[model samples]
Target: MERQKRTTIYDIALKLNLAASSVSRALSNSSKINAETKALVLKTAVEMNYQHNAMASNLRKGSNPTIGVVVPRINQDYFSNVIAGIEEVTYSRGYSLIICQSNEQHAREVDCVNALVNQHVSCVIISIAAETGTYGHLQQVLDRQIGLIQFDRVVDELDTFKVINNNETASLEAVSHLIEQGYRRIALLEGPQQLDIFRQRKAGYLAALRQHNIPVLEELMYENAWTKELGAVATAKLLDLENPPDAIFASTSDFSALGVLEVAANKGIQIPKELGICGYSNEPFTELTSPSITTIDQYSFKMGKTIAELYFEQTEGKAQIKPKTISIKPKLIVRKSTRRK
Candidate 1:
């Protein structure tokens, strides 16, 4: 039941009655160690099941070929795809990835970043938490000259490499689609106002209303409804209103839009017939649901690859560079959820 002790160079040296340094040189196949000794140490290493600590050696040499990524949640399809994209590029470059989740908390995000910094990672890629309060932790990364790349939910004050989706334009296009469907008096399920992405989404929603000469009703806008539960609660409240909205846009996330669809179905509200629905982030489940949700595809995988490529090309791949911002435009995926004529 007890775990076996790992065999180190010292253990191999003690067993072979050779100096630890000689054993290390033999294991490394160094020229200083003759072929006979190298072969003997290697044979002994196999017998002892000795493993090399390449990372520890690399760390001591100040060349940690590892990248640290911090995201809100790995369970979410968007973040998972992003990580996979990053892996594709990093793996090819002979680098390893250290992934950490922030769980949408500022404190945890700081802790993850700090751990990455302590590890002396080559780069730190992050999509900040919803609680956008301070920049000290992020600033420390730049101070240490460690490559920092911020994507999606980024803070404007931080002058770092950024890869983001054009949330405003995407949201504008989504809302405009709802309007063209003749859905007047549309309601919005919003995210936290502190984050730029949410604010940009709100701006896009407002911009669309203004573009179509539609009056903006403050009452129809529900704040902090980025989750499925909040979206359902907002839907129930809006549906109960004396003059309920004919369309609901869960601009926060696909999860929120899913909530809207469920509440509408339970209330016998025909989607795109009596009420239109739309969501952001084209999660996998969005397409599978009956009356599939109309949502915006942020190309999360492409975004991830872009982030990784940017790090290699800009950070060490280039000699000198300025802080760059790369914005990827999201596409609108119209499905059965909002296809009314």
Candidate 2:
């Protein structure tokens, strides 16, 4: 038996007794075509199971109808939620998202950016990896004139559109909260200072201490304590110090804060009374811990939406959108861990 031929506009036009040009124009929704004709054309097209040639449509509009999203790790709660928010808006606008993960490496991040560029993606959204300090790869995207929008963990050197939380402000608030609870000798577990976000957080902690008239203790600050194990190591060292800190600002992320809590528990240190703790990134697990961790909510999903909408506004030739840095203020989520008795 012979295979059936695919349906086309000509077939629909023949059945409806309309000219092919009229049918095509109606299907394309040309404003010149009458509404009744368009409705009839659409109804007939649907009945004929005619699949619109997406490639032809995109070429005509001079767009790929796809956005490229590159994250350090898609498994992480923060990145995953951000991607979801991007999908929510882009899907409705007839755009598809092509996602890539960098696995927290500078080399991989560069590769991902290059891959997206090759695909001719209309826009590229990124949350830079922890190890990415030199932003030549990011600059390449900008050089290519691709719409590049960065969110959450972003590079500061690149003068591009960005949707980011006020990391320094959030860190300052967290430190202030700790100080208000009478945590005088507060130690900080910092992530890699190479990334702008972590660097801002570290600065915020220092500023808060200065504002409260607390002397800067160089010994209490540990740089590159980005992981749980590093947090545990930092905690051990801090606790062994002649003047151990009464509180710990785990500015790295919630994982680091969890380490602080676990180590304190093992050492028979009571929370809040003996050792106060605070974290960043408001991870879900932070709330379920024995004494819920005090953290900063960066509104990750909203940041993603903001990035997507900004990209569209810039790419679609809307009113001249300026290349301005939009900062989303983070909220301090106080929990039992940081509460003073």
Candidate 3:
């Protein structure tokens, strides 16, 4: 089939009896063009279905006004809010965003990064996949002189700009709250330890135990139990124990906490009285769940905006800016799930 010709500035110029340069300048919203002429050109261009050749324009300017974002899952509340926040700033700056989801796979994450690099994006913002082990893919971004911003699940070794929640401190506060509520023998549902965020959360749990002079029990800790199914399984196993925990901390996510609540309800366990529950991420469903879950609010949307602002700040100046980490302290939201009184 023959391709339909795309409307060009020259076509609009010819129809309006104006110079092509004038049409081009008007389309670009140049200050040199008169308002009346610009308005007329724009109206004519719109009538002709003329689309701006951003790619060609960017190529000539030696820069692409596009930001690429990679996350584990787009459906998740935290990541979605972050993306919305990023778009908020980039849109105002006349920049576009290309979002990709890795589905927590290393290969998919690498592929997404490579595709973005090939597109010559201005910057890449990523939260490393749960299965990520190698830094070579991230290094390639730096080698190409592309701006890299790592948020949440970051690789500590890479010298990239990072925006992250204080996972350790938030976890500590959550666990401590559980302890203060008269719930001893608190259990922990942990995410993959390969990621630093999970490791830090585990550290926080341990620190809280130490502070309270409680012995750290190995059996109470379950690894790779970040999902609802895994959390339910872990909860069943813990409840079956001869010396079961009084409270459970789903340090991985709120979904895991929901699993705990479901399993406990099935077994006729009373939340906060017989079994207290707490979770992380402060997901919307947490508040809606029966008895409501106590959780940590990571300010995910704010974190994303901060990440974009940080990138702009770093790139705006002429002087060399060193890679830096910006830590946003998370807040512990106490609810009926963990309130024993």
Candidate 4:
């Protein structure tokens, strides 16, 4: 369906038989406009369903109290919870949020950031997309002297406030837990290596195996198998190997781990006995599944709140302060999926 056009000042002015400037000044409650005229314009504007454009007014004053948030996929539970947390803090502070999704495309991400810049938002919060290989667009935000805060998936070299989970440490703890459970020959479903988060996780996985005197096998590590479908495909490939992994770690996400679980079940493989599964990002669905998933709790909601709260603390009055980094540690939650007798 076509969108309804917003009622503008011109429409209100025409209805009230007054100039558009008069309508604008009256709506703004200017001292030059008589009280009776201002009240009439306000009442008429309300009657005509006309809304004031706060953004335009704010832009004219060389500031915008609105914030822009961009994520890979808004439908995912992690991103949704993060957005909710950001809104909780920003709303309370009288700042509005403008959310956008990149759908994990680099070109789309650039466009989203550019659009937010054009609107002159107070701050731009982003968790970079998987396909984002370039940093020019992100640099543009900094060039404009706008507050740029990167969270979850961010560029390490950028001099901006960064809120991130300790992915490497979390991954180490997870893989070590698997080792302690006697799961030898573990397989890993990895995400895009271009992103720092995935690379750190992979580093953690390798470190854990070496620390336990276990030789790292290149065949056991699957590349870019971060999604549910990709995870299942990777699992099938791993299971078909001459020496299949006794345990699988979908370090990218719980969705991928769910894929691993489903595929193992379909093949009649006994979980935690014939096979073991572990995932990351303790999604809500992890506990609901049969033989619940072992995962890492990244505190996505809290991460969101931290990022937003940081923006307010550091950017008040647009202070040109030094960049800072805050890293939140994730906890490992062992469950039936990886638990063994």
TM-score of each candidate structure, all chains considered together: 0.93, 0.84, 0.90, 0.89
Better by lDDT, candidate 3 or 2: 3
lDDT of every predicted structure (CA atoms): 0.93, 0.89, 0.94, 0.93
Question: Can you tell me which runs of candidate 4 are displaced by over 4 Å?
Answer: 1-50, 317-319
Off by over 4 Å in 1: 1-3, 13-19
Number of clashing residue pairs in every model? 0, 0, 0, 0
The candidate that wins on TM-score is 1
Q: Per-residue CA lDDT of candidate 3, range 186-281, in tens?
A: 999999999999999999999999999999999999999999999999999999999999999999999899999999999999988999999999
lDDT of 2: 0.89
For model 3, the stretches where C-alpha displacement exceeds 4 angstroms are: 7-50
Judged by lDDT against the true structure, how good is candidate 3? 0.94
Q: Compared with the true structure, what per-residue lDDT tens digits does model 2 show for residues 167-198?
A: 99999999999999889999999888778888
Off by over 4 Å in 2: 1-57
lDDT tens string, model 1, 98-212? 9999999999999999999998998999998987589899999999999999999998999999999999999999999999999989999999999999999999999999999
Error in Å for residue 289 of model 3: 0.9
Q: How well is each residue in 1-341 modelled by candidate 4, as lDDT tens digits?
A: 99989999999889889999998889877998999999999898888898778878888789888999999999988899899999999999989999999999999999999999998999999999999999999999999999999999999889899999999999999999999999989998999999999999999999999999999999999999999999999999999999999999999999999999999999999999989999999999999999999999999899989988998888674666678889999999999999996
Clashing pairs in 1: none
lDDT of 2 at 229: 90
